[model samples]
Structures are given as C-alpha cells and as structure tokens.
Target: MSDRWQEMAVFVRVAESGSLSRAAREMELSQPSISRIINSLETRLGITLLLRTTRSVSLTDAGTVYLDRARNLLAEMEEAEQAARGVDSLHGVIRLAMPVVYGTRAVIPALATFMGRNPDLRVEIIITDARQNLIVDGVDVAIRLGVGQLDDSTFGARKLAVVERMVVAAPEYLLKHGTPTTPGELASHDCIIQQGAFGRESWRFVRNKTVTSVRVSARLWTNSGAGVTAAALAGLGIALATPLMAEDELRSGRLVRLLEPYQLPPAEVWAVFPAGPKPSAKVRAIVDHLAMSLGEKT
Candidate 1:
C-alpha cells in the first residue's frame, strides 16, 4: 500500500551492502533519501530493522527474518514486471538446474539452438542428479524427471514430456551373454545399474498394469548417468537408461533395447519453478522451448 516493495528492495540492498552510503551508491539514490526510506519502513512496520552506527549498519533479529522474505518478494516483483512487459525479446542469464543426463543430452543442444535464435539471452545450466531448491539455489527454472505426480507442490511445474526407461545393453554384450526375455530372469544376468533418486539400485518394471522392482547385482554401480551409458556402450552389462540419454546409440544400433514386453516405470519430464506470481517471461520462454523440442522427440 505504501510502495512496500520499493522499501523492501532498499532494505535488502542495505542489508547486503551493510551501510546506507554503500546501498545508496549501488541504487543511485542519495544517502539521505535511503535513510528516510528505512526510517519510514521501520515506523510503518513497528520494528527496529537495523542497528546503525557511525561506520556500519546491521540487521536486528526481526530484520534478519524479514530480509529473507523481502528478497523473494523482490525477485517475484521483478519477474512479474518482466512477464507483463512481454517475452518477445528476452535478454538475461537464466540459471537452470536439471538432471545431468537430460541436461547434457537434451537441454544443452536445445540451448544451442535457443541461444542462436535469441542472441541476447544466456543460460547457465547446473547439471546434477540431486534435486535443487529454486529459491535457495537461485535457480530460475529446473527440469525434473519423476514418475507421475511430482512430490513437491511448492514449485510450479509445466509438464514437458513422458520419459521412458529401457533395459539396454551393447549388442556385443547381449551377443556374448544372451538377452533375457523376462524381468525375473534379470536376476541371473549381470545388470549395470545407475543409482536412482530412491538411493537404491532397484529397477522397477511394469507388465499388465502390475509393477515389479528387481534388485539386481550391479556389475558396476555409479551415480553418473553418463558413466552408466558409457559402461553399457563398452559392453559392461545391461543398464536401465532413458531413451533420450542413449538416443544416438539406440538409433545407430550400438546399444540394443532388451525385455521390450516388460515395461519400466515411465517418468514425466517437468519444467519446474519456484511457486509465486506468474513466472517470468525469460523462464517461460525457455520452458516453452523445452516443451516444443522435447515433446517432438519423446
């Protein structure tokens, strides 16, 4: 009601800079104006936000709590402003977090084309199997693969595509060890397993609407999806991999899909963002680009 957002922005900058003079310099506002804003904010909120001295300013306990919330509010405010303006010509660095496998195989290539189209936009991709918090990690958008519904509803999700897992091995490995026809028989075969989010090497398969999880001995177990793909390519053993991760290998007949009749638990690819007001235009643009490109492929 009282231009609270502006006050919050000024407050956050002051907290970060640790002095009114520094914050004023950074925000291009007079030091007196910055002091007046802080005074007005503290009076309105009925709380002492800063302990000011001749040379420094520090947040009180109340200020510490408010600062955290203020930062998020300011970010959402800027995003709302940008979205309202439109997404026709996007220009900014978007910090995107996604799984290592998909990020490398799909997102990286799509980004190449996206950057070519929008010469002004830059993307920073954080590739990891671990899930990252959008606000805490400062990630604008994140691509996640999950079975059916995502567990956390605090983040908004745009369904991109369905990810199908294939039990695959190199032709040389299959030729030497003989491909198993049933999911149960996987117990006897040497299976190269990539550790999934569940922190286990159990591979889940579905047939006739019934799901079964097979805990196979890993000829080699690794957290890296690329490592798993490489192992399978080198005739190490059977690995459960997403089609996109091994798209080229699958297409070129370097890796062969095994146990086709038995289905693996399918994952839905989602573009996720921190829950707030409508997403920023830059975020939407990248998410839309992924949906278009990945949708066609999947």
Candidate 2:
C-alpha cells in the first residue's frame, strides 16, 4: 500500500478501536508499528490526530475531521473496486448494536431475511439496553428506540418507524384490580416500568388535543422491554409498551389494552450511525431492511 494510504487506514482503525493495542491486534501488526504509523501521519499532516494517554486514545479536533474524511475516502475506494469487479452483492461485516428486547422481537427477523439475501454479508449484533457510543464502540449502526433518545447531530439518523405506545395489562390483573377506565386510575394500579434509556417512568396520553400526563410507580422495574411484557403477562402489573412487544398476547386476549380513545404520542424507532460521511452501502441496506420490517411489524 502507499505510505499515505496505509497511515490513514491505521489511524482510522486506531480511532475506531479506541486503543493502539486493539488496532494492532486486528491489523496483525505490532503495537509499536501502529503507534509509528499514527505518529508518522500526524507528523506529515503537521497536526496531532490523537491525544494518547497511558490507557486511552482520543481524537483531536483535527483528528476527528480527518478520520471522518479518511473513513469515507477508504470506504468509497473499496466500493469502487467492488463496482469495477462487477460485484453487485453486499459483502463485508456490519457491527450493529440494538436494544436487547427490541432486537429479538423485531430486528432479528428482519436481519435474517437481509442476510439470507446477501450470502457474503456478515452481521455482528451487540444487544443491550444501555446507550451505545457508536464510534467508540466501533459499531457501524445502532437501533435506537423512543423519541428524543437521539438528540444530537453528531450522528446520522433515520426514522425507521413511529411506534405506537400502548398501555396494557393481563386480563387476570385487570380482573383482580379492576380495569382502569381512565389514565388517572393508573395511579392506583401497580405499573411495570422498563428502566434504562428508553424507560417510561411517566405515561402521557392525548385525546382531541387534550393532553394528560401521569406519573407511575412500579414495583417491577426491568431494563428489558421483554421483561416488562413478561411482567405484565404474569399479572404482576400494567406496562407501557409498543405493539412490537405484545402483539401475540394482545391478539390472544391475554393482555388487554387500556384507556381507549386516549392516543399517546407515538414513540419513534431510529437507525443511528456514526457522524460524518454517509453510511456505507452495507449499513444503509441493512438499515433500510430493518425499517421495512419494522413497518410491517407495526
């Protein structure tokens, strides 16, 4: 490889890995080699690309800008080579992050279909409820749930779907505690809360432009969306969830939707990616596939 090309690639890997050692291991180069390449690149550019401490590596302001452009340039180059070779199918690995429950319930099926169509493409999924730092985690994409969860312009975002928020309870629980006729009655009932970034500690409802906000207390606080659904199914408490979480149960009459005609503001599902540069073809394709699948699910 040309010296400039190799140096920029190394620097991008180091930044994505968040450490010299990790980048070195991935590239099958010695740590010293990785460091030397970064140093040489910085020296040639007349600007520091990284601020390295004993334990961590962070991008300088200029480094961030360069990483963005360099990554885009390299990606485009690879894609160009693929196009020239008449490789029309997707290839390469995509590291995707998603919420634990949401991934299982909604994303997996979509991903399965997408992967099936592209035999050469590989996907690595990291499922969790905690917020992911996409660039730092080396994640190509992350599926974010709820409105306002992705508030910054530091990343590219696509609205996959507007998920309807439903308040539901097991028939047993409702029968025992009496079904809530109004959103106000929820205060007297035990609610199931999904904790973490997408948690709803309070529920909001709207009817004919009238808005109602109700703060709820839950004896059961679980971080997973599936946990909330399981709790509601076990007759533990009422839960605020999406149709994606309770479709089967709701259809089976195991869980009953509460407070009719009070339309809650629809929450959103987003496919988020690192800031700067348009996402690669693989990332864009998978995100679009997920959006289509989620639309069908909803």
Candidate 3:
C-alpha cells in the first residue's frame, strides 16, 4: 500500500508534466526509476496507463480515469498531514483566474464580503478571457464558464451556475435598426462579438424541438465582454452576452433583449481546482462560499 501511494504520485507527476523525464526531474528521481515504478503500478493494477513512444507519452483512457482518483487520494493525504500539524490557520494566498466581466461584476462584488470574513486568507485574481493552464500558472483555483472539459483525474470542478446568453441591443439602437425577431435576422444587423474563450461565433439555439446553429460574422470584435457590452450600450450594434454581465444594462433598460422567442444553450459557470486526495480547509472553504454565494445570483 505504501509503494502504491508512491507509484500513484509518480504517475500523477508524469500525467501533469506530459513527460517522464520532466516528472523525474520534478520528483528528484532518475527517469529509469520513474519508468520502473510506473510499470510496476501497471502490473499491480492490471491496466495499461501510458502509451509511451520515444518522442512522447500520453495517458490511455484507463490512465485518465485512475489519475483523477489518485489526485483525490494525494490531496486527502496532504490535508491529513496539515491537520495533524495543527496548521488550521488559513493564511495562504489563493491565486484564481477568471473572465474579466465575471471577475468585475460577479466575483469582485462577492469577494469584499468573503475577504472581510477571512482576514488570514488573501486572494489574487487574474482576470482574462484566455483559458490559462492552472498548473503552469500556479493558480490555486479557476472560475470558468461553459461545460468544463478539464479531465476529472487532473482537476475537480463544481458547477456554480448556469449562465444564459441573451441577444441585447440598446433601446435606441433597437428602435433605429429594428429588433431581430428571429435568429436569421441577425445577419442583417451589425453584431458586436466577444471572440475569445466563449466562442461566440458558433452560437446554438433550440426551436421546435430541433437544435440549430448559426455562424455569425461580426463587424467589431473584442476579447473583453465589457467592451462588447459598451458597444451595444452605445447603440452601435447587437451583442450576445451573458445575463450576469448585462444585468445592469438589462435592468436599466439601456440594453433590451432581442429575439426573445429563441432559446440559446446556457453556459455553466464552474469553480475548479486541481484534483487531489483532500483539499485544504482554506480551499474547501473558499469553494463552498463561492458556490453558495455566486450560485444564487448567477
């Protein structure tokens, strides 16, 4: 069982680093030793984990599944060690990455209250639309929107909320250009799009029990959701945006929903962390608080 844990750790390192040599260097072990441990693990588990070639190695499907469980086990073991040391103090920095609009409008607003409650804990938030590599960036947590594609063995994700996208235009713009009664009419209008991680172009909708898709060409493109919303507010064009980002404008009547009849698929907001045995008290607390607070509003 002790050897099993060591082998599991080796496998996890390899999976994360994408190369046995890199994992060996990180673990301060020889490459041959790492390979031997992994082979021993495969023999014991009766499952082939890595498909290795001279050039590179990748996880087989079984490897991917086992990796997630192994991570959870390691995390739990770390937590147990911390608890035994009486290190219950939540005084570590938690680095988080999230989209700008969500960070500003949703997360930032909620953070003030969260921070006030946990004085020992500090948070560093990076706001960008780009999907950052959490391991490479040394990020503790990530707030992402959409169906999470992060492998279960490598990362753990909890759905925070379902974010519905809406077609919105400033009241003045809608009055001038006329509202798009249907999805097809959007082609005739000047569309402002957010062109980054959200993939706004490949828009999907459901009508009459049939799923339909449309590829939109935008005259103005910005990676910032705020920028796109601002363009829409200025009566420049129609914008597709999440309800949370457009909540203020939508409520103030600055931006009005167009094409109300068609329903678009909602993107899920998630709080994700690296999958390991047991998460620390601080990480668990933050995730729980964020899930509870942000879930209701979004």
Candidate 4:
C-alpha cells in the first residue's frame, strides 16, 4: 500500500508554500524527494493536483477541492491523536496573519499575553497590510480590518471589534494652516494619503444622515502606517489613520483630531480561519483571548 499520509503531508506543505524548494527546505527533505512523492501521489490518484510553472505553483480546480477535504482529514487525524493522549493543552506552532500597523500596536500585546498563558504553544505572525492567501500560506488565523463586511464566505469569520478612522494633523501643522472645520475645506489642505493595500485618495464623513466624500490632494504618499503617522508628526501634512495608529500621538497632544462633528465609517476587525474543518483548540483559544481583550479597547 502507498504511504498515503506521507504523500498528503508533502503535497499540503508544497501547496501552502507555493514553491517546491521552499517546502522542501521547511520539511527538511531533498527537493527531488518531495517532487517524487508528489508525482507518485498524482499518478496513484490519476489526477493532477498542482499546476507548476517555472516561477510559481498553483492548484488545479480538482486540487482546490481536494485541499479542503485534505485539511478536514488532517484536522480530524490530529484531533484523534490528541484525544487518545488525554491532553487538551494547546501546543505546536500556530501561524497567524495580520496587517503590519494594527498587528504591531494591538495584536502583538494580546499575543504576548496569550503566549504567556500557553507555555507549549509557539506563534509565527506574518505582518502585511495586504490580504494574504490564507490556505496557500498555511495561516492558522487571520485578523482583517475593513470598512464593509468582508465578501469572502470561504473562511469562518468572527467579528472581534470595530475601529474608526481618525483625520489628524500635527499640532504645528494645525497651528500653521489652521484646522479644517468642514469637509469642503479639506481640499485646500495638504493631505497625506496612504498608497498601498488600504490606500485611499478620498475620505468620507457622515453627520445627521448625510455622507460626504472629499477628494484631497497629496504631496506625500506612503504604503506604511508608521510612515504616515511619522510624516504627520514631523509637520509634513495632515494624515488619515486608524485610532490605534494615532492613539499615542493624540494622547500626547502631538496630533489633533479634526472635523469632530463628522463620523468616519467604522472598520470591523475580524478573526478568520479556513472553513473546511472545525477550528483546532489552539485556534479557538487564541481567538477567544483576542476577542475578549481587543474588544474592550477598540
């Protein structure tokens, strides 16, 4: 009989990493050996699971369906082993994904506490503002922030908190240019716009059931949240930032919030996981911990 479990493990790792060489390195196996196992699996199954190119690898349609099922099977197997051992403590590595700024400022603190509680568990956090391919990346959980409900139904989502954006400027900038009281006045101000992932050249404000969108000009643009906050603090220009991003500066009176009468659309913070399988104990533990902790502040 074929070593079906071994082949499945190899295939899953290869799919998640998106590169055979990378998967081989992670699994501590030779590239040719990994390739052979995948080939044998495909030949035995009589279906091509992956579409390989010189530069990248992707799943075939059948491979996508198989992936979900495979995950379910693996999760069940792990649960069986854990149950047999009569131990429920969280262990092993949990891969997490989240945006850079919020993850650093918010999630990391909560994660530090969680790690302290679960001594056997290790976490690998991937910080990016861009939405990562969770299944392909092998992320155990993802924390996402967005203005509208996330359209993806493939992942099981838990809404953790809602965060509002803040329009802020350095105290010196507000003093030099004067603060904008109306949405229309923002056009005349030099606004710093974030440029990548969650980039927006325009901002929306609402008051008394009326919503207004103001397209502002930018002399400075950045992809990093820290960069936008830094530029604002240096008196470069006004910046649009999440409350968490501007919290310290706002508390110190280095930055001032403008147009307080209007409201910005609140972004929902979500903890998401792959849909096929029941969440592992580790996933549930961290999710609950974050929801309880971050919910209070946001």
- What is the lDDT of every predicted structure here? 0.80, 0.83, 0.78, 0.83
Model 3 Cα lDDT, one tens digit per residue, 159-261: 7777778888998988898877778777788888776546566667787887777776678888777888889999888888888779888898888987777
Clashes of each: 0, 0, 10, 0
RMSD of each: 6.2, 2.7, 6.6, 2.6
Tell me how candidate 2 scores on lDDT.
0.83
Looking at model 4, how many pairs of residues clash?
Answer: 0
Off by over 4 Å in 3: 1-78, 81-89, 147-153, 207-210, 275-278
Higher-TM-score candidate among 1 and 2?
A: 2
Per-residue lDDT, model 1, residue 234, is 96
Cα lDDT of model 2 by residue, 1-298, tens digit? 5899899889987898798997787677999999999989998889998999988899989998898899898778767866886765687678899987777877887877788888888788999987887766778888888756666467888988877888899999988999888888888899998876457667888998989988887788987888888999999998887887898999999999999789887878888887344777777788888888887766
Any residue pairs clashing in model 1, and if so which?
none
- Please provide TM-scores, in order, for all candidate models, with all chains considered together: 0.70, 0.86, 0.67, 0.87
Estimate the overall C-alpha local distance difference test score of candidate 3. 0.78
- The segments of candidate 2 whose C-alpha lies over 4 angstroms from its true place after superposition are 24-33, 251-254
What is the TM-score (0 to 1) of candidate 1? 0.70
| Predicted candidate 1 versus true structure: per-residue lDDT over 1-298, tens digit per residue | 5578779888977886678897786577999999999999999999999999999888899998897788677667766766775744576667788888888887788887778877777777789987785654557788887665676686678989877888899999988988888887788788776655523457788889988887787778877778888999999998888877798899999998888988887778889886344566677788899999988877
lDDT of 3 at 177: 81
lDDT of 1: 0.80
